[model samples]
Target: MAIESVVVRQRVEDLDAAVPFYEKLTGSTASRFAFAGVDLAGVGPFLLFAGSDEAVQRVAGVAATLVAADLDAAVEAATAAGAEVVMPVQPTPNGRRAVLRHPHGGVFEYVGPS
Candidate 1:
């Protein structure tokens, strides 16, 4: 998989509550989207997320979201490199996503159209 941009995900207590701070921090207004019932806003290179404890926990510690040219290939490459799949490939607003924990214990999300 050809890696592209990486987006960082930040957990927040409240979506609306967090927007202005991030807007000022990034110098860019956020574009909102929902994922698995979680309210998310794309603010610059960061994905600010807010939701239930369970939902937040589900994605917690995913240090970065890696964009790729091909989602399947990315998953394959990750698995082949001994990364454990935290979640199988799934649909998202931008494309498909899969979370993985590398053998060394680093966590990340991979995304791409296909």
Candidate 2:
């Protein structure tokens, strides 16, 4: 599957406060959204998220989120490449996603249309 975009993850204590800095840096308006009880802001290639300890911890440790043309294909390619499934495919705000841990230990989340 083709990778459409990549978003860097930033876990912040306050999403509202963090959004302004990224907006200025990227010269783009932040698109606000919420998922699994976490508040998120997308500014350019950065994704800033903030929420309660429990909520934030649920999404912690994911280094980046990638938009894939096909989530199932992405997962299959990842597994064939020696990646382990950390989180199975599941529904997300915009689509579905799955988390995979590479053989080298980097964790990545892939998202695509539902």
Candidate 3:
């Protein structure tokens, strides 16, 4: 068996504020969608949404994780694009990784084999 990909979904309070930051961070434009009264933006493996606080709370602290080819470069790019470091890049028992918060509030982790 094989797993294809993962999509981490987050709910935001403001869709407008979320889109630009994600677009910049991912270096990809958001493809918008409407699902269950929420506005969504497909940012790489993340599905960022804007809706009620109650719904948003459901996924709090859950982050989208990606395996990067160049962990340092990825962290630099994310920072340059406006993401704040949630956890500084460091080596773990498993590998090297960094956690960042998108300007819109969604968190993500970038990991790479070292």
Candidate 4:
């Protein structure tokens, strides 16, 4: 399967403060989305969010959320490759996604547009 793109997700304590800094740093306006008590902004390949770190820890740190053309197939492939599902495949406010942990304990998210 071809990997489309990887997005790095970071959790911050404050959305209001984080957005402007990233907006200036990336030189682009952020596309906003809210889900599960978190506010998210996409700045290029970086997905910055304001939420609890503990909640974000379910997926691990600085790991890329891999975008797939076929999310279900991606999950199946990941599972077959020895990646444990951290978050099961499900439809979110934004899309269909799941988090998988590599054998080495690194975590990554696989997502597709709903």
lDDT of 4: 0.81
The better-scoring model by lDDT among 1 and 3 is 1
Which residue pairs collide, candidate 4?
A: none
Q: Give the alpha carbon lDDT tens digit for every residue of 1-114 in model 4.
A: 556999888777787788889889889898998776667888877788876766655544637889999898888888898989988899987789988888888888888987
What's the TM-score of each model vs. the native? Answer: 0.86, 0.90, 0.48, 0.83
- The sequence of per-residue lDDT tens digits that candidate 3 reaches over residues 4-103 is 3556766667888988888888898888865435566777776787777665543346576666767888888888989899878887544687778888
TM-score for candidate 4: 0.83
Identify the runs in model 3 with alpha carbons over 4 angstroms from their true place.
1-60
Model 3 lDDT, full chain set? 0.71
> Which segments of model 1 are wrong by more than 4 Å?
none
Cα RMSD (Å) per model?
1.7, 1.3, 11.7, 2.1
What TM-score should be assigned to candidate 1?
Answer: 0.86
Give the local distance difference test score of model 1.
0.88
Please identify which of the two predictions, 1 or 4, would achieve the higher lDDT against the true structure. Answer: 1
- Steric overlap count per candidate: 0, 0, 0, 0
lDDT of model 3 at residue 24?
85
lDDT (10s digit) by residue, model 1, range 28-77? 99999887778899899889999998887777778899989888998898
Among all windows of ten consecutive residues in candidate 4, which has the lowest summed lDDT?
53-62
Which runs of model 2 end up more than 4 angstroms from their true locations?
A: none
Which residue pairs show backbone clashes in model 3?
Answer: none
Write the number of the candidate with greater TM-score, choosing between 2 and 4: 2
- Rank order (by lDDT, best first): 2, 1, 4, 3
